[model samples]
Target: MEQAQMPGCYRHPGVETGVRCTRCERPICHACMVDAAVGFQCPECVRDGSGTGHSRTANQPRTIAGGRITAGHPHLVTQVLIGLNLLIFLLGRLNPALIDETVLIGFAFDPDLGRVVGVADGEWYRLVTSMFLHQEVWHIAGNMLLLWLLGGTLEEELGRVRYLTLYLLSGLAGSAFTYLIAAENQGSLGASGAIYGLLGATVVLVRRLNRDMRPIMALVVINLVITFAWDGIAWEAHIGGLIAGVILAYAMVNGPRERRALLQGAACALVLGLTLATVVLRTAALT
Candidate 1:
């Protein structure tokens, strides 16, 4: 009988084999054979192909320092949130009429201004809803760009649920703060508050991770300065959102023993209180 053609292991040479390595298509012996998704491959090839390594034991779930589960893409949640915000902003822009006084009054955060005007009136719900709305293309683009750049690292470190909670809570805090600080009968709209919240969360993460935050801090300061210095910018909303974000971030990073869950709960509760107080104050001042 003729000897089977030996092509040698595809990944590692000189080792003669009768069967091919499934990954790299080299011949190998039974000892080097590995069962895989496509077909059998040499152990060396399988290790590289599977990306799990040759000595991969049973599928053991790994836990991080905070007992958070790691997934294939840790930053997916942040991406989705930013995507949704952009989609809403774009959809709102498609028809200029769609983004009217009614829409803005109903959805955007206003300090009971419409109510004082005795026109259609402003709803308290706008505070939370306003975080999802953006006025201009540039506005949405800038916000999403920052989210893409900064949100990934935060989501990876904090996990999806926690990261989302932080983002939303920060937005609420910002909106609430703006309502509280805004002159009664004034209207404000945009996702700048929520974006500022993300920045606040970034500050907390930098401190916790013990990394240099000089660059980020400088960026935040510059942005704040620009917001105040620029025209047509709602500096109040930015300040409010930033304050809320810092508080929410601090709670998330350094809360009690059950820090993650506790901080999340506290953030929600705090937002509710702030919202209610802002509404009451605005209504009283407006009326």
Candidate 2:
């Protein structure tokens, strides 16, 4: 009698193989083989045995909408903001003249000029530009550190566009508050207002997630104390930013899920409108 040749792998008909699946006794190619404790098995056998106690299946992590969560990474927007701030600071250092002529007079929030000379006279941009300006090394260092910490978390949760919007709005709110209350001829410039806004946003987001808010609350209290204790600190800006952040976060989190985007946009627009109105009223009072 003639000896029979070993059958070819089912997955690869052209090639001949001696390998046999332990479970199904089917010939398997290297590509189709699944390693088992006892022996190699064919893909079909492995799939068939997947329901057994020894078999395991991996589950993808999901979010609110049954969508799978993507891999986590550092927040880009936060990093970019930090870089821009540092670059501006370095440039100001190189040209001290820039601080007086460009940063302070033209960009830093000057309540007296903003109210008296008006925005068209080069005071309007200060509300926004002030956020990226810092007078001292320690000032930028502290603000940047806080921003790196809190901003990353906010950006991850709220996404780039929303986080950026919140940050600028909060900063503007801080400037507006300062304009309304600060002494005439007093000028403010720093990222402190925006950093405070991040802290407030973190608190609101934590509350929304039903997580403990004690640690964050403690931080807020401590920072507020520091703000008051230190001379030349813009406590008003801190308070204003915090209030604006809380309101904005609350509006975003509590809005209807079906129309969340729309609601958030409306809420932000409303806050901005109120800020503009406050500026108008304050300027009018001065005039």
For candidate 1, give the lDDT of residue 128: 66
Query: What is the C-alpha RMSD, rounded to one decimal, of candidate 2?
Result: 15.8
Q: Tell me the whole-model lDDT of each prediction, alpha carbons only.
A: 0.63, 0.71
Q: Which regions of candidate 2 deviate over 4 angstroms?
A: 1-73, 102-120
Q: Tens digit of lDDT per residue, candidate 2, span 1-287?
A: 99898776675454467888776688865434555666676655554555233323423322221122234453878999999999989988887645544332212344533443333244677677778888798999999999998997677557667788889888888878887777545667887777888888889877765567799899899999999999988887898888888877766655555676677878789879988987777766655
- How badly does each model clash, as a count of residue pairs? 4, 0
Lowest-lDDT window of 10 residues in candidate 1? 58-67
Candidate 2 residue pairs in backbone clash: none
User: Model 1 clash pairs?
Assistant: 21-26, 22-41, 113-185, 174-241
Give the number of the best model, judged by lDDT: 2
Q: What residue runs in model 1 are displaced by over 4 Å at the alpha carbon?
A: 1-67, 101-122, 255-260
